[model samples]
Target: MGTKESDGVDPRVLRTRRDVVDAATELFVTEGWSVVTHAEVARRAGYSKATVYAHWPTRLDLMRASIGKICDEADHPEPTGDLRADLVRGLVDFAEDLAGGHLDRVLGGLLERSGSDPVVDELRRRLYEAGTRSLEGVLRSHLPEVDVEPSLALLVGGVLTRGAFQGRPATEEFVADLVDRVLASTGRGEEG
Candidate 1:
């Protein structure tokens, strides 16, 4: 059975939505949230403005779709069942994303415009959940229930601060040291 026919939706409609959302995500990530107008997304996706508007009625709609796409496409390292190793790998990948400038732009855009709109706040929450899913899982598995969130914050915040704020690379040594420090502080310490 043809899935589109089965679902009673046209394949063309699906393609248009996918194209438009991809374009919107690309624009939002590369140029920040301010540039993700319907007109721009329409232009980038090679769709008519009216077509874009027909699908997403407002700028926030476009932004919400774009943010959803970003979260859907987030890539994180696979966990190896080793808490420290998993965290290091995840943080290293995150650092690379930050260093590549895409994640930072997305985060900066969301943070800059956050708190003014509930939708934007939800988008920020979604992004955070998607971004931290892996590390959060590792932390939950290895740490006390009460310490999970704070430890997650400390680890991710350290990486974000080092890479984004301090403009320094989250090198392996730095990340390993960070993991050791957090683990020690949490009383998990390093495993032999």
Candidate 2:
């Protein structure tokens, strides 16, 4: 059985929609979400304004689609049973992703605009919650019964504080050490 969203929509249509969404995301990340107008997206996507409007009736609709694409493009790490190794691996991958200029820009924009715009605020909240879910998955696999909220704060706070505030590169060694400390704090380390 073919679904309307999957098999019914033509490949060309999907490609064009992706192009437009990508263009909008780039604009939002680079120039701030306020700059993502239908005209600009159409121009960047090589589509007519009418075509953009046909796909997305409103600017907010386009913005929501772009945000969805951004979230969809993010890496979601899966736990591999070895807590320390998985944490280290996942954190290293996260550090690399955060090091990208596009992600950095998008995160910065989300933070800066979160307070003023309800949509951005919701997006920011959802993004952080998504990250927490991944971290909790790792912890749950190792801990018999654990409260993961504090651990979530620790892991996310450590990364952001180290990279964004301290202006330090999240080297693999640093990430590994951080994961070790977290495991130790939660009584999951070798000595525990």
Top candidate, metric lDDT: 1
Per-residue alpha-carbon lDDT of model 1 for 1-192, expressed as tens digits?
124432867779989988998999999989988999989999999999999999999999998888877787788767788888898899998999888848999999889988999988999999999999989988887774555888888889999999999988999899999999988988888572
For each candidate, what is the lDDT?
0.87, 0.76
Which ten residues in a row are the worst by lDDT in model 1? 1-10
lDDT of 2 by residue, 1-192 (tens): 113455678899989888898899889877776788999999999999999999999887887777677666666666767888887777776676666545566677678777787987888876666555666687777774987777767776777778877888888899888888888888877732
> Pairs clashing in candidate 1?
none
Steric clash count of candidate 2: 0
**After aligning candidate 1 to the native by TM-score, how far in Å is the CA of 117 from where it should be?**
0.5
Positional deviation of 34 in candidate 2, in angstroms? 4.0
Worst 10 residues of 2 by lDDT: 1-10
After the best TM-score superposition of candidate 1, give how far the Cα of residue 165 lies from its true spot, in angstroms.
Answer: 0.9
**Per-prediction TM-score to the true structure, in the order listed:** 0.93, 0.82
